[model samples]
Structures are given as C-alpha cells and as structure tokens.
Target: MPQFSLYEEEYHPSPLKRTWIEFRNSHIAVVGLVVLAGLLLFSLFAPFLAPYDPLAQNIDGLLIPPSWTVNGSISHLFGTDALGRDVFSRIIYGCRVTLGSSILLVLLAMLIGVTIGTVAGVMQGVRSSVINHLLDALMAIPTLLIAIIIVAIVGTGLVNSMWAITLALIPQFIHHTRSFVRAEMKKEYILASRLDGATNRQLFFNSILPNMIEMLVVQGTLALSIAVIDISALGFLNLGAQPPLPELGAILADGLDVAYLAPWNVALPGLTIFVMVLAINIVGDGLRSALRKRLVR
Candidate 1:
C-alpha cells in the first residue's frame, strides 16, 4: 500500500465521467448515440435541411424514382411520393413528429407511473394490494390492444394516439418501479433511516429516489423504442398523424399504393423507422450494462 500524505487523496470517478467512459467504450452504444444525435440534429434543422417543403405537392413529378433513376430529378433525391412530395424532405420533417411524440409520451408515463408505483410500494394493507392487482391486470393485456382500445374510446388523431400509447405503457413502468421500491424499502439502510426519525417522504426523496435513477434511465430508454413502434403502428393504421402530415408510418402507408413504381418511397421511411428503433434499443442496452458496472464498482 502506498503511504498518503495529508494532501494526498485517492481518485474516484464521478458518475457522469464514469457513465461517459463506459458508454464510449461500447461500440454498438457509441454508434447508436451518434446515429440518434444525427437524427435529432436533422429533425431540429428540418426546415433548413430539406430542400423542398415536405408537404408541397409537385403534381408534375408524381411517381418519380430516386435521383439516380432514369426519370428522377436531383431536386427530389430520394424520389417523390404519390402526391409528389419529396420523400427525403418528408422523412427529415417526420423525424420531429415521430421522436417528439415518443419522448413526450415516455416522460408522461414515467411521471405518472413512478409516483403511483412509489406510493403503492411504500403504503401497506389493502390499498397496495388493490393497486398491484390493477397494474397487473393492465399489464396482462397486450400493449397494442390496450392502445387500440383507448384510441377507439378517445377517437383517433396524433395526440390521442400518443395518449393511448402512454396509457398502455404506464403499467410497465409502474410495475418496474413498484418492484424496485418494495425491495428497497426492506433494506437495512432504509430501516436505519426510519429509526433515525426520517419521515417517509424524506427517506423516499433523499434515499430511495437516488438509487432508482439508473433503473429509471434504462427503463425509459427501452420504453422509447416501444413508443416509437407504437406510434408508427398507429400511424400505419390511419389513427395517427393523418393525411398531409408526413409522419414516417403514414408516409410508408401512402407509399403502399405506388410501391411497385416507387419503391424508394416505402423503403426509405421503413428503413428510417427500423434504424431509429434499433438505435434506441442499443442505447438502452448499453446504459443498462454501463450502469450495472458502475454500481458494482
């Protein structure tokens, strides 16, 4: 062992630093991060990046193939849709709608779920049991079916679709959080805090919440992928984004009619959705691994 002087100190990595280091070390995670960041930047700058208005119709250019194809123009690089909107431009703009709604849905679900789950976990007796049973019943239903039912009840639209998806997802977060909280409640440190006159609120806010951050982050990211899929599925079903809006799934749906003549229209949006969901899942997995290692250290 090395002798330490009064001024000497042992080094320990901060949480942020460790997290970054771990994330950077994961190749899949790094790639996912880069792709996601690029998409976010592209979405943010869609108005500037897109050469043409995504919604603008060019009737003369309808069914045009990609730029490299015989009848295609460089102006519509990824080709034109049935309505003659530039596929590339629509894709760029659609990113904002798809990612934005998914993120908002996740945030809402997390806020509501975590609060209810924590309360259910902390409280004793019949209330907790009732809450648990309710959550379990919700979870037993397929998320897509639940979303469809909610959407049917509330009517169809982008906002309503997201709300439906959010409702479907809440049970998952609540179950996860409740399990973690219940386990944490039985730990020795929690008992000691209680013995030291710490209020339930104080123990929760100060002690429990901090430890739950890693789990929440991982869950939130994984939820994002599912949310994206659900959003796209709803859009595909004509229950989201609607006509003239250029959402990814709606774009793909529109492309179906002219798919044979204009394959790029469908392919581009489908590929974008696939890449987006894949990146999110990869990042989520990386976070889970990296956070677990940090906890071990």
Candidate 2:
C-alpha cells in the first residue's frame, strides 16, 4: 500500500494554468496566439521598431513602390504613400493606436456592462425586464451603425470614436452578463450559499462571478475584435483618428484616394486589419472551447 505523508505535495495547477494548457492543445489556437502575440509586441515596440516617423513626409519619395518593385529603394521597405510617409512605419504605428485603443474600450465596456448586469440579475423583477428590453432595443441596431450615430453626435476624433464604440459595445456585454448571471443564480450552489448566509454581494464575488468568469472572458475577447473593426470603420469614415495619427483605418482611407498610384498604401493597412481581426476571433474561439471543455470536466 502506498503511504500518504502529511508533507507530500500535490502538483495541482491553477485554473489559469490549466486553461492555458488546454488552449495550447489546439493547433489553430497556438497559431492564433503566436500571430496575436507578434502583433501585440510589434505595437508595444512601435517607437523602437518603426524605421521612420509615421507622419514625416519625404517629398522625394512620393508614391514609391515596394522595395522589391522596379525604381523602389531599399530605405522604404513598404514604399511611400501619396504624402511620402513611409507605409511600413505608418502601419506599425497604426497597429499600436488601433489595438491599444480597442482593448481599452472593450475593457471599459465590460466593466460597466458587468456591474449593471449583475445588479439587474440580483434584483430580478420589473427592473430586470426593463433592462433587458432596453438592451434588446439597442442591440437591434448594428454595432457599427450605433457607433457611427454616436460619433456623429459627439463629433469626430479618435477619443470620441473610442467612447462611442464603448457605449455601442456595452449593450451586448450587459445582455450576455445578465443572462449568464441569471442562469447561474438558478443553480443549487447559489441556494446553498444563500442558506449559509451569503449576501448578494458575497454570493456574486465568491461564487457566481467565479463560475461565470470564463464565459465573460470569452465574451470580452470577442468584443475586442468588434471594437477593433468599429474603430477602424470610424477612422475610415473620417470620424476617428485624424491627420498624422497613423491609424490603420485612416491610412486605408488615405490610400484609397491615390490607390491607382500607390497600391501598397491601401493593401498593407487593409491586410493588417484583416489579420488582426482574424487572429482575435481565432483566439476568442479557442478560449471559448477551452473554457467549455474545462467546465465539462
């Protein structure tokens, strides 16, 4: 018989570690993680990585093709735009602005949404139904359209667009969180916790929130992709980051005017946005799968 010792340690991994291990098991998830990480690192180190100031114009380099193209120079790898700004550098800086702002916007949305949702869930009555009705009405419109309307009212600029996107996104988060919390509240554990003298706050913080966190995390990840797209869309429409901002959407918009002369300007920024959204969705799907599997176990 194996002897059990009081000092014997068990190698129990944390939930986060377990979730990561599960996430790593998927090939597509790993690929997504790598791509997302690379983009994030590139954005984080943009100041150091970018070869030139994104806003600086080089009159001599206007509309230069990619470096490998005929008449292209090695100095400007992705070539120059109509304004003679380095396409590569602008793209690098654009990633920073786009991704950084989107993530923050999503987080802010999640915080406000979750708090309101939890309150509604705990106080299920006419108030909860009213909140749900409000969310349904808001969510009926497309998120981008809602954002556009908000931006139109608040006026343009990156910061205003971000706020608009945050407001647009909050409805979805609130809807999902309220549903999740309400469902979780119906479980036996919640009843037991209540019987044991757990207050609403204690129940949420100690039990309900923990069980629902995985879903919230996956929801937030998905919302982040939406935020990125909406931000870029606003920028493309001239309602987001303005002149010299090097926002991906703005760069793409700028490229369109001179696309016939400098195709790389349009292509690179569009491609970057596509890749960023694809990677984010892949990671979000992976998280959902991993968390669901863990819950089943």
Candidate 3:
C-alpha cells in the first residue's frame, strides 16, 4: 500500500454553535448583549448596589434633583422622588419587577402555545383547521386590547395583569409554532421519514422538533419584547404592579405628577424602558439573521 499521511478529520460545529458564532460576529448584537447583561446584573444585585431603600421615605430630600444638578446631592445620585425615595434605587429594583415578570409571562405562554400548536399541526384534519381558525380569530384582536379586557374582568393587580398578558400572548405563539410545524411536515424529509415507517410521534419529536428550535428562539425573543411592553403599559394604567412595588411603569406614573419640578423622574424611567425594548429588538434581529444564515448553510 502506498504511504499516506494520516491527519485528524475536520470538525464541524453543530447548528446551535454555528448560530452563536454568527450572532457574535454582528457588532450591533454584541452591543445589545452587553447592555442587556448589564441591566440583568443591576437588577440581580439591586439589594447591594442600591444606595438607599427603594421605598424608604426621606421627607427632607423631597423633589431633589440628580447629583449633577445645582440643587442635587451625592447621597441620592439620581435624586429623590416626591415621596423622598431614591430614584436610582427604585429604578434598580424596578428592573426586577418589570423585566423579571415579563420573562416568566413569556415562558408560560410559550409552553401552552407550543404544546397546543404541535398537536394541531400533527393532526392535520378538521380538528387542526378548527384550532387554527380559533387562533386566527383570537389573533385578529390586538394583544394589548385583549390583555386590557382580561384585566378588566379579572380585576386590577400585578399578578392578574401578568396572567392577562400571558393569555393574550398565547394566540401569537400558537399561530407561529403551528405554521412552522405544518411547513416542516410538508418537507421531503418528513415524507421520506413517513415512507420509512416512522411513527408520527417519532417524526415529530425527533425530526420536526429539532428543526423548529431556531424559529422558536427567534419567536421567544420577540415575545419577550412584547411582554415587557405590555407589562409596563398595564403597570402604568394601575392594572399591574401597585404602590411600593418599585415597578418601572408605576414609577413613570408617579413621575408624571412632578414632571414640571423634576423632569429626570419621568425621563429616566422612560429612557430605561426604551433602552430595554431597543436592546431586546436588536438581539432578536441578530438571532433571526444568524439563524437564517445557519439554515442556508
């Protein structure tokens, strides 16, 4: 036999690994990741990082401006609200209330939506059509409107509003997942798997579910952004988090009262929500692009 040099075989990263690598290559995505991480960290360590208690009143420091302002003090970096509570401290704690609750809401919605959607897609009969039609009808109504209606019926409160938001979000998830599953089912590979005598359950769990991961990740990010907005809106309307909770939307509502005297109060909380939603959208777009490239490969 002719002498041949032996070398290790080339290695290929998995689709998920490749998608992550691609996501990292996008500079905008990296910036979004950094900003989002910082917010999460700030919220996670708010107990230690907050200079003062979010709800602790300081009658003496009422309406104080930010430290940079002429009338401001270093003790309260972002200054005090009308109630004399530290603005910065309230914001830090608010992150947990706003973002944290949105995350849980999205997850619950996703679980219920994915389960029902998968079943609807696999069935592919009158039953499936009925389910899809129901979802379509629900989706026709704006999610915010649906949420508001639900809250009206359920009564105003943070937990109730979260549940209302979750219900509103479910239709969207079901519609997207159902479409994805149906499309995958029609592919040639799926047909081949059927010809090979694979069970419907096996085809779904093994073949279809694996391929749907990328799409689901994108959808989840989009849902998370929506969740944050909806939760904030409800809080602002007094249907979500209540007083003393340090929720961002509630803070904004309070800011409106003293906006003329201390504009930073409104501006800061509004800016925080804007930045958070922007970062989420950027990360979602990056994921979509990365996953699209992965599919093309």
Question: Which predicted model would earn the best lDDT?
Answer: 2
Which stretches of model 1 miss by more than 4 angstroms?
1-8
Q: After superposition, how far is residue 140 of candidate 3 from its true place, in Å?
A: 2.0
**Cα RMSD (Å) per model?**
2.7, 2.6, 2.7
Clashing residue pairs, candidate 2? none
CA shift at 158, candidate 3, in angstroms?
0.6
Tell me the RMSD of model 2 versus the true structure. 2.6
Every candidate's lDDT: 0.90, 0.92, 0.91
**What is candidate 2's CA lDDT for residue 259?**
88
lDDT (Cα, tens digit) per residue for candidate 2, span 189-226:
99998999999999999998878788788998999999
Instruction: Tell me the lDDT of model 3 at 143.
Output: 83
Tens-place lDDT digits, model 1, residues 1-297? 987688867898899789878888899999999999998988889999999999899889888888898877887789888888889999998888898889999999999999988988998899999989998898899888889899999998999999999999999999999999999999999999999999989988999999999889999998999999989898999988798887888888999998887789889999999999999999999998888777777
The global Cα lDDT (0 to 1) of model 3 is 0.91
